[model samples]
Target: MPIKQSGKRLRVPWRKKLDENGLPLTLPTYMAYCAVAGALRPWNRLGAKTIVTLVTTDDFYFPLFAEAARYFSSQIWHPQRYHGNVLQCSDKNFRHEAEALRDERAILFASPSYQIQEDDRLLSDAVVSLGPRSARHAEAALRRAGLPITNESVELLLTEPWSRLSRAFQDRRDALQAIQRLRSLPKAIPPAASEAESPPSTPDPTLSDMHGFGSSLIEWGYDLAKDIADYKAGIIPWRDVENGVLISGPPGVGKTMFARVLANTCKVPIIYGSASRWQEAGALDEHLKAMRASFDESREKAPSILFIDEIDVFGNRGETDRHSAYMRAVITALLQLLDGFERRKGVVVLGACNYPDLLDSAIKRPGRLDRHIAVPLPDAAARRSILKRHSGVTLCSADYEVFDMATEGMSGADIERLVRDARRAARRQSERLNSLHILDNLRPLVKLPSAYVHSLAVHEAGHALVSHEVGYANVADIKISRWRVEGEYRALGCVEYDVGADRPRTRTFFENAIAVCLAGIAAEIEVFGSFSQGAAGDDAADLNRATELATAMVGAFGMGHTLAVEKFSPNAFARMRSSNPELRREIHNVLETELERAKSIIRLQRAAHQALVTRLVDVDQISGAEVAEIIRNHRRPTVSLAKPERRAAR
Candidate 1:
């Protein structure tokens, strides 16, 4: 048979290099293969006289480098002469061999730790540097090689002598022996206490010790705390414990603080990792390595809490195309660590993210981060508690309530900032921190643009009027405060209402709610010549809610044009719109009808609306009772005078 040539050279981008199972290839192996293929190229564009390359890799991955060189030579280089072409030499004789090679393809793989003596030939244009493998690199390598080594495995490989021996020898018997030795290690003994020693007097704060959590949340925290206590007391096995929790909410809702408090309550040490810290390490590969190192550290300190902050960095895929592949691979590595081969017993992984919707579903699946706890923005009572906790001694119960009322729609962090600002103001004035100081500092922070105050008053007054007219008894309070702005949307004002317990709500109730929702926009248009985007956020939310309500009424509740209930998904309106176009039209029609009803109601209660708007603009806020009183006082005349003669005849 004639000698067969390998034909054109095969090249892979460093980022796209993968193993058979589609995971990222280890950095050393990837570098070695790329170097070998480059050296074997028919044309040496880099001005190299010889087709030989020197590659430096980590000591631990030296074997993988050799394996990669051989595999690439067979698959890419000339198959018949690959045996003679590929060479793995130590640094001891690398200098002489590299200088002597001429018109021959060769690859010299050496450990990065090896210090090669200065040689002219060794300092050639074909020197490739593959630095030492990191925890991330090892993970990528093991995954590419179809081995089941993870961060936990790395921890065991480092800590357990038998496990290390097993990995070194690649034998299960050695691994079993290592496990036996780990079990046989001697336990430590505590020193005897003196007679004067006494037990601690104070009660330790556990999950139950945490404040600001709701009754249900407190119960949940108590259960977790109890579980940890029981586990420590040897009353329960580690397997019976929940593995992890996912805390999600808006920023400054104390998600991070909650994690710290939970760890303290559980009496376990916490390992903190932030996504930005990992990204700061530079390349995606380095970021993965850092992330894996964090997990490994948590595993090493077993019976600990691992808190990964701002985890939404590994969000759902397909959001971007620029670095989609790189990001997806990173997420894959994270998923592997989260629900990998190892079953972590004592370690509890807690992740906190503001954008939970953006996170990958795989991360939230069972056996990984299964428990989801929402840390909501503090309510009035919670806000009061938070203010009292953060405020100086100058603030009393009355000041707390006033601060709480003023901080409506503000997060716990926002309140903390306000109190901090107040303290600074008091210190600057050399006086006690009082309500006046707080109010003065808070006014500037919560002040709205002068032009928008009237518009906001009109908007909130409209919602209050419509809600009251519709007999929605849960209406609590309405305010025109510029406390916080969410994303790109500015909050001019808001109307607070309670739905009054969970129950099967009717279509009439939904329609009434939709009317109240549109009342803000309607009121703005009625008062101002034209409505502004101040209600844009509310407009979007109301439209979505109306569409959902209309869809449910037609498809699920059978309360539409035809009383025929149909089984459909929640998003069926968009998917089945072409076949049943009326579904969308009816939804729009419902919203339009509600809008017109709101306009008519505002028109009928025009005097009352004006009174409410005036009070809101002047006073900045009004209680639900004040709103009802104004409406009651400005009631429109029910008896019309258009047919007075007919009434006299009767």
Candidate 2:
């Protein structure tokens, strides 16, 4: 058997290449199979005892390899029948199976990996590794096959593996039909450009449909969209255009949607990928392969936008120890791709994450992902636009205004869910969608409390009252609400005030601000007879601000009792008593004295405080004007008497 005279000639059809669909193979597919076939022939000629070929490819193309093994099994030399020789199994199961069947002659189809276990080498006489096929490989194969497709079509097919092109074509047809249905709807925005069209020269109006439209969150996106449009129209040089932008924001703030709409507006194709999806593609090597493939596909469709969502998952080294080495390698690969992106003109990389700070410093540097834009929560006007877009036609302008007021800090996704919930509520009640239905739906979704509304009212009222009394003068508004179920954190209420544009504030101003901060806690104690955890957030924030102010006054501003400039860390005051026991006692006395002053002021304005709380509890919100009116009506008069004469007589 070892001799060359042991005649065995495997006559596989070397020049014939067919894709999974039984059509003439594209250049990449032909090259990939040819590589596999070529690797197997050498082992056959050497009279190998066993052979296993590990082909690394897109998950969609795994079936094509199984088909090729079957079609060529008869012509290829194998100890087992051609049908039974080709084995497709998961990497984990392959290890166990390879150990049990070491003597069997088979070709195993497994994901690509750089690390081959010792057991695998012991089980097979020969192993061949196949990487993803590149565009050049496809071009060469097409030339050899004498196919009649243009270079552009070849590029398009490169966006996907050869097996997926036919499937993608069918999906495109379905998508077009769906677009037709959407366009027929009442007031529906314009449909997105088909894949064949060039990038648009104007911004898509539907961008406004995204949440946080008027805010800075999407401002950069709009700018990018305009630049893309300009670039496509030949109005600007490609060098002037940005190569990549990082969109950082909270979840459901429309970061992913904004990328999609921007690409749509620019009329360019988009390739959507995510770190989670890449991680799910098998082992570390497979994940890396998938990441490279994603970028490669995006490049194949040049001038396309590559959107990578949840990019924070590939955090910087030292961020997490669980997958340190693996994720570091992933980040390194991504950095390389981003840096090389400049060479591929018309290609832009848009990465999104909730934790931009977690990304490596290298990725955020000037050459790669330099344009970091924050997609903040929607403001009032943006919220209004979001509600109007999601709500039914029956919702008038006034309804939108009301919703905007109600959904003060909600994200776009929250507004959309609220509208859908409201519609469901109306349907359940067998009634037309009305204000009551919307409000009812909102209560559960927002986690609006039926009981603690009064406490929240008093809490916010205290801040407003204290702010006005301290001459803040511009108490913009006071708002109260219960916990929102969909919100990230529980918010009881807030008092918005403007301190005016005054620089180098005096000690008195700092004291006033501290009092305003503590007023909520003080009010809860005064009105409810005990404090609740609702003041925990306010207390921590106010204490920190107040301590910083006290530290600055003593250290930086030289407002201490000794008239000497002494500097110390802000937290040093808390432990000052242990070192300079007397000085620490004095510092403690200062804050105690301020608290007493605040309590005294509250006592004096008890009537005004009660009025404000009552109004707040009744309406859940009040304007600065209403607070001022209550304070004015309940002002205590200044009474002058012969105090000096009385004291002399005594």
Candidate 3:
């Protein structure tokens, strides 16, 4: 049957808007739909009228035609195939068919490319027009009912179109596309088992030239001379000769600089790269290939160091080892290659990571990173030396008394930062190179050192006295103010007590342990009638540690002896991490018990406590001689009642 239009006599329904690629050429489609719809509205006055239509082409107008049909619900114009509405041969056939239907008051909406003679065509008032074509007349033939379009409006519609999906939906689609792309790549090949060998160090293991490198490692109390001496004598254990050495430590301990020193000492070139860079840009395989190439390139220069910085992330993320498959494969390949190279001829592999705990076991086994040496924060003497090196000033013998006490508990990096800040201040103030600049730089407005020193001494002294009296820890020399170590604080005072060889397990001993930990605070409270914030950080740390051990004894270690409950080692720190509700109560109760016990003990030993505080405050910096004098003058033996033990603490 011939195509039918609405009873209102509108132009043909536009159904062909999409081009070959499924994109819409919207301008012509809009014009066709608008003209046909507008013309057919007169038919809708009676009721909804149906239209029949056909579209021959699928370029520029396809989407618009479909959209209009859906919007108008034109039932009569059910164009199942492309040729129903448009007869492509000539405009005359199309116009004659339209005239044949003119008596029925139906309009035929044909493509704009078709032409009809005026006699055959309906009068302008009888037929509804979609709109004029914006582009070539070839595109103007297509029309739809109930719309009109100008050139600018058509261009605007064609230029800017809308997508059905939302932004979030688009992202999900993109991710799916990427995943599909990844699945298409070939599987990576695994390396053979026999390719593992250690890299070779230089003939002169200790390169004395390190003295001139001007790096922070040398000045930060790294003990270069000692490391060099040990290496020269072969006293230092060479770990992971096959894979590489993995150095682990917390941040700001100079790990990177230390790695550089090791490379220079062994006379090797440093090849630095981070394992994380590979995870981005879908470039893991490429990164592995580059790593292998790096080994080959550096081998020619023998004794070069392949430093894989942050190797923990390089491990396979989801394999049996919990690392990525590619990462594990790369690590395996690296280890095998390292093992295969007979003599590094001068190549060494060194790896650095702050998180050694997260590393794969394979990396730390005999063939990989075998030696684990802890690079701790600096001690007091090291801190003093570090200050001298960075500040470019030496402490006088007179100031050593004060200088040594001021730097306790400090790290190497801390010392360097302090020195740098001191120098900057000097430069700012236009002062000559002097020690006062350093003092001014390091001195906080709170003056924590002196107050902290006195408090620590008294605190430590309380621990000694209480431990001796209660028969727990042995009393050490009870040095009033020794500040030669890293992070030294001038204390009100601290007493040195031997924590004993065995980990105390008995209830009384545990109580004593609490007492000993609380002794410093007890001493502070006794002398000052209040505690200083100087002890706040240390007290919290010590309290938490002691509480953990105590809780473990009660809950997990089966030391409670009364509870008789199933022993389970609940990690206090981990529990805290998980935000367990009971932790606050349990920890608080334990601290309170210990604090009350400590207060009572100090009250009983009130006289001796007073004498110790008086002497400590008078001297500001007490020596062994002064401690002994105070001990004699007070008629109390300097030695604790209990004999001291010689065990080292963990």
Candidate 4:
């Protein structure tokens, strides 16, 4: 049938064929149908029990094409013969529903390659695979329907996936547009299993050179490396070697890096795998197949490490939901593999994830990913070592003192980025790497380290000092940095302080927060004689934040003069602040009162604040212990603070 488009009549052959066969296919199956047509194009016919195995660039295509082959076969020549009852040979129930493939007539086999049989003997003739060409035919059919896509895209399409492409087509999306979207989707199929093993880290900085994996983690890594060597040398039995380990931590803490380091230390190859990778292979069955293949591959490459980066994704059977049965099966299958993994000689398994709590209990049981080690954010000493290695420069004691302050609470990965950014910035200036570069990179705005260092110190110090004076927990310390860790947010400085976690957040609690938020500008005004506009930039600005908090207190908490309720959230304030002039006035009054309150504290703690500014300017960072010591040295005269009245808060 002819269909009229924008100007001309168009005949889409694939559409005509689907109409003729009463076939319905989503985009994936349609692509699969195209692959089948391409596979059968060379052959005059698909001979009986035609056992052929071919590889696709991405495993995602196999199952979908298998279904497509069934559909296309059903609609083609000898359609009756193709019925399950008559032929009854399929990996699937190929031609029909469950009952259709009766036990009596069924013949099933799997082959790694194509073969067609004549007489009693099987004959084989290899043909070009059902790959790019088939996809090209599918594109041609779409082009016939007045939709043309690139050959390169078709080739790339054959190489990878379209979970997104298929879903996009669910709402009558154009076939060309759907396939083209794959150009931007994050690899629908990750690299092959072997490619999954990151190419060996170069000698420049193998994981061995890296620091910040806690001593326990470092000890386990070396022990495992030694065990692998001893096992290979016949000095120890497989049982004597640690069966497996599960390294857990937050992201950017270098859980995966530890595995690579272990492999390097062991002098063995490492193969990385994860449940998510297997899932990308296609459906449940294909996922299992890919997973099993990874195990086999690890065994093939003995004395190897199989790192499962997302071991937590394999949720055990007990945690089943309607949608989780597939994952349940995955978890069950993984458990079976991990159980058997212990017996695989010369092979070790390691699992990593941000949330180990979400992992199957069985996976972390006695013989599986058992030896759990947490990779915490590096400590001050570890950060120093990491910075020294990554900064690629010499540092004096003073530089390190400042760096220790800057790098507090940073993960190994964060340190890595800081060093990288610092180097890049210094490189652009054609200067040798220095503390300035390192500090600047740590906080993106540390560019004017000499000029702005004291101000950022003053700002963050204000937060900490007020956090202290506001009857919150004593601040531990604060840091400023130039080095930027890749995954960490780009920033100049952050205050490391905490009130008691279990402390109740009453009206006083919020009021205290408002004071801390405003303290930076207040401190600036008290000492520097004026506040810089830097006190208010971005939504995180001290002034902006104080305003948001004050609005919440006045309008939502009903802590102000009036008891009228109003919507309260950070950005939700502008309307209420605008419409209710009384609310606006009360908010302003609260901010003013808090500013005055913070200034008074700053005034009393002038000696301490000045000392803090001097210390911060000298090092560009300081720890809570230091902050505490400084504040204690310049203690304020005893005075009573106004008690906050009880008020309901949002």
- Residue-wise C-alpha lDDT for candidate 2, range 287-312, written one tens digit per residue: 98998898888889877899999988
Candidate 3 lDDT, 188-249, residue by residue in tens? 22221112111244333233322322334344324433443454467763331233567766
Please, what is the whole-model Cα lDDT of each candidate in the order they appear? Answer: 0.65, 0.64, 0.52, 0.67
Q: Which scores greater on lDDT, model 3 or model 4?
A: 4
Q: 512-606, model 4: which lDDT tens digit per residue?
A: 88888888888888878889886676687778888888888778877778787766566668888888887888788888888898888888777
Evaluate model 1: give its lDDT: 0.65
Model 3: per-residue Cα lDDT at residue 47: 33
Q: Model 3, residue 151: what's the lDDT?
A: 49
Instruction: Please provide, for model 1 over 1-650, each residue's C-alpha lDDT reduced to its tens digit, 9 standing for 90 to 100.
Output: 89543334232323334233232234344434544455455532222234345555322344545555655544444333234434444533555554436434455554455554455245443555543323444344345444577555443332232223323433233433543454465422222122112236645555544556556655666677789888989999987888788888888888888878788877788899988888888798899999888889888987888999999988777668788888888888888888778766688899999988888988899988888888778887777667766664445655544555566667888988988888666534334467787777653343457667777788889888888787666566787764443233445467877654563466666677778878887887777756765454443554555666667766677667877766767766556545777776777788888888888888888999999988988887798788878888996854321111112235
lDDT (Cα) of model 3:
0.52
Measured with C-alpha atoms, the lDDT of residue 299 in candidate 4 is 87
Q: How many residue pairs clash per model?
A: 2, 3, 91, 18
Superposition-based RMSD of candidate 2 using all C-alpha atoms, in angstroms: 25.4
Query: TM-scores for all candidates?
Result: 0.50, 0.53, 0.51, 0.45
The residue-level lDDT of candidate 4 at 577 comes to 81
* Local lDDT at 622 for model 1: 90
